[model samples]
Target: MDRRLPVSPATPLIDRFGRQITYLRLSVTDRCDLRCVYCMKARPEFLPKADLLTLEELTLVCDAFISRGVTKIRLTGGEPLVRKDVITVIETLGTRIGPAGLDELCLTTNATQLPKYADRIAAAGIRRVNISLDTLEPDVYRRLTRGGDVNVALTGIAAAKRAGLKVKINAVAMAGVNETHLPGLIAWAHGEGHDVSLIEVMPVGEIGADRSAQFLSLENVRAALARQWSLTDLPDNTGGPARYARIAETGGRLGFISPLTGNFCDTCNRVRVTCTGELYTCLGKSGRIDLRQPLREGGRDALDDALDAAMASKPLGHDFDVSPGAAASVDRDMARTGG
Candidate 1:
């Protein structure tokens, strides 16, 4: 005999899909130091402080989500560390949940400022860090980032390592643009004791149309690597939703994120909060629920309602099959959209 009971639409916590919303990607600010060509065309005006979510308001929204089963929180942005008093934000959230209570509290930064803030970050109870480093050559770095200091970024990675934080390097693979140095970057990360994530060039922001020229899938990259090195699945290191494999001769690991050719949406468990407080269920979607208006009007109840709507609207998967021109027309610039 079965003893399971049916759930009602009035269920207080779970969403329509029965997937517990347990992760929140909070974008602290839309401002960034580097204007990476793929991320933005030019420097953008800083969003007015009044328009952005205040610390108190952000905490309230986070609390609402936490109450509904959100256990992991990540701080992101055009570059999260660029915001002032960011440490205060981290500390305030840390007080709500003990170090072990929250399943994970992580962050993603470009790493230009990480070297200086690494210690403060570790002290604030942040455990995981992902630094974006696409190229090893200084000239190539300048070309991609539109004149970013590659040396500074490298130094920041080293500082994070010294601070005892779990660090990962995110390399956005673009063919003819840093593809030749892919192996070298992986080997360097391995030697430095950091995890390397090779991601497919995803067409997500206002520049999605331009992706046709810059975007390259991970399939070609995997084939190239396989020919040069023997890969074996790593033991006991199952990265949720993504595969982690090891190279035979190297003491390093490689990660391939193939969203174009292969999709992992079935296991997707993340929700993004725009800097202006809009909640987006999927990264590829143009629609988002504006929480700012409701939050300013009704407080906690409003936040809960907004979160519920976002979870309910979570799509089954993203459609990159849409023409690049069409994709760009619908979405905001990547920096503004919190990619």
Candidate 2:
């Protein structure tokens, strides 16, 4: 069974709405060192190692997407660095970056294990990394991540900088938790020459907490910051849903990903693949297409067919709601959904 996709290019993955899918967020593992309150439960039931797609299979999938015109691949996970030999995955994908292949290869990590792998990550051709740092207060960080260390994450950020990897901070804005600290966090991140994006809590998985209570709209966040800092809108698109603004005070960029307050579905150009090879066309939707079975059972043709099916079924937008007492729009945790 030859599982490799042909080197020739295929038709671009364009949805019914006419948006070309050029980005893929591939999760290598669902396991993480910290259980962020908004992402997962304190004690999550991780999938068995045998259930995940093998490294070879992952590469095959990447090749398939690249053949179909997906140019940017972002490695994501509960924590991508926690995946064993993840650098190998990065290195494999890095080879695809060129004029005729992928334009960029990057990663999104919680940064707990980054200090150990930053140099290797940079060497593997990852020029930029998006690090998750919700709060700078040690106590608040511990409370949000369920016993995780903030200093460790800080050290990882420093290491990533030392390795010459551009850093971007992703902070999930919570109403009472990190609301007040966000200003200072943004200032500090900007001062350190790192971009920061503030995200509103999405109704993705049930983590035994009231999401409505935790939900802090980016509208409010931006308004609050406007009072303190001069924010001028910027026309920068990072191939994601985030809307960018330049802070006049910090002379830094700030992004806002408001899945609830602002719907970014009309221009969505990406898809997420779980570690188990499940393709999620929309993060706020539960619909999925299984690519692992096709790759294993029918090889390249079957996998390409599955990818086409996924693009066809890609929804116009997600229906994420954080209204009081509303259940999660998607029951899968952000960890399992590729962050």
Candidate 3:
């Protein structure tokens, strides 16, 4: 039985700055198999399972957003596949894709579980995925992810390709870490028919490391890549912050997401909801509304009110800084806030 609420026309969610909210990055869980150095601590405390919204609750919240004009929903997490019965959430949302409903439904994953769920994910209406892969070298990958096997992720990527799902490799460019190897990684991803996007490491949480040392600006990256390859800017956007370019040498598209060096908040059209149903209007700011209580206590009407409140409180921009010896912009880790 389809338990999702019917999508109906409603006034679109527009922030004070007039940016219409069309994209929702909803985190299904805070639990993950690998603890990346930049995302979380090696021995981070996991969120209590009881604190997370149930699959039914998640679906209802999504449907409410759909009714209010959210067209693109990206399921994120501390590895969303680690959540039990996540496919149920995916399948439910899959039915909502059409002219009258969602324009696209996608997820960001580490690709460790793609080998197990790729076919099922494709069948559930997900046409593409963004895989977080920072390094291709085995030892460096293991050290970065704290015991994760690169081979497993590679196998998962292959499985995703075989299942007919478009894959995009998302690498966090860190100074002195994977900076030297990124060219090879990009070429390999392009050779494998996958688009690649390099992201500047964000200071989201206290990972016990100096973020300034890790922060690799995309401006420097592009200049270096330009010297090696003929790069041409493209007017391509995937409803996110990435700026794309065509790598003429590989005949592939490359993207740069520079939240620090480049402020993308002017065109920001998305908000995030954590697994616990906390709605964050801006990722770099700590302001959030508790949608779980309203949804659980007062149902759809209350949920709608909370949504409106979120839009009204949406900040025009984020305040992310990665200066030397600087603290994290927000107290919450990327996993808790959604990756």
Candidate 4:
């Protein structure tokens, strides 16, 4: 292991491979309101409240990361909105970390719970909102999310836009499930003044165990869209390897996150932390630092050293591309992981 760590606290915390770690995806809670089949099992075993990180502890962790060059922080979860006091958690982190050089605070949600809190979340200092809506058709949406109401999600999206929050829709395109709805999904989001990105169904978690049939390549979907519309490549700086293109006719835009097809690992610049506190260096590969233990026993300096040591071993890429879509067979449930 390299004994040297980044000397400049203002610079990004660089790993052994020289990737600057600027983004931190923190999962505040593991409980969700809806059961997305592709994400987790229908009835997931929720973590005990005592085991999850508290708001103050999360703030401390964020402060530590910000000092080590984590500028962007995104709150994720099984469905973060389900957590009581979530708004306060968002506000606390945003308020405490902003002056310390935290550049952006964002969250990924199912939108099922957003209508009630979208305005407040925006006011809480969330710069952008990523809505996870796999399909636009109510029936298909219900089928995919197992009884989720698309109208409520649409209402939330409207509320988010009205609140002046930059909104993006993340759709996980599955074969025979949502592949046919790609064009419509993009059209609907675009019509609503939001850009939409289609992600290939990942083979992760127990839900991913038998998902070979569900995997749909974004490449194929892009090809189909190209047949109908003239697509223009657009520059994307969202800090992820997702490629963006403009739909020439509708003046809309679409992003494709081809993790399996292209393995964006070379450009990987983020890390994830489960609500229970395991810091995952890579979403698709193994090896994580026991952040909960360290955060509980070690305090700031100990946490810093632990993070530096673990990040040094961050993998170059994942093996998902080894089998394209089915190779990365992760047993950890997506709900439990800070996905």
TM-score of each: 0.90, 0.98, 0.98, 0.93
lDDT of 3 at 27: 98
Number of colliding residue pairs in each model: 0, 0, 0, 0
lDDT tens readout by residue for model 4, 1-339:
111222334435798888899899999888988889988887788999999988777777777787788889999998998988878778776674456567898999988777788888888788799999988888998988888889988888888888898899999988898888888888878888898888887767776345777878788899999998899999877876679999988788799998887578887899988888888888887688887777778666678877887778898977763243545456787787876
Candidate models: Cα lDDT each: 0.76, 0.91, 0.94, 0.81
Better of 1 and 2 by lDDT: 2
User: What residue pairs are clashing in model 3?
Assistant: none
Worst 10 residues of 4 by lDDT: 1-10
What's the C-alpha lDDT at position 2 in model 4? 13
Per-residue lDDT of model 3, residues 1-339, tens digit only: 267654445789999999999999999999899999999999999899999999999999899999999999999999999999999899989998999689999989999999999999999999999999998999999999999999999999999999999999999999999999999999999999999999999989888899999999999999999999999999998999999999999999999999989889999999999999999999899999999999888877788889989989999898888999789999899999998
lDDT of 2 by residue, 96-208 (tens): 88987898899999888888999998997899999999999999999999999999999999999999999999999999899999999999999999999999999998888
Query: How many angstroms is residue 309 displaced in model 4 relative to the true structure, after the best TM-score fit?
Result: 1.4
Predicted structure 2, TM vs. truth: 0.98
- Give the per-residue lDDT digits (tens) of candidate 1, residues 156-202: 98889889998888899986799998999988888888888888777
- Model 4: lDDT equals 0.81
**What clash count does candidate 3 reach?**
0
Q: Give per-residue lDDT, candidate 4, residue 93.
A: 67
Off by over 4 Å in 2: 1-4
Q: Positional deviation of 152 in candidate 4, in angstroms?
A: 1.4
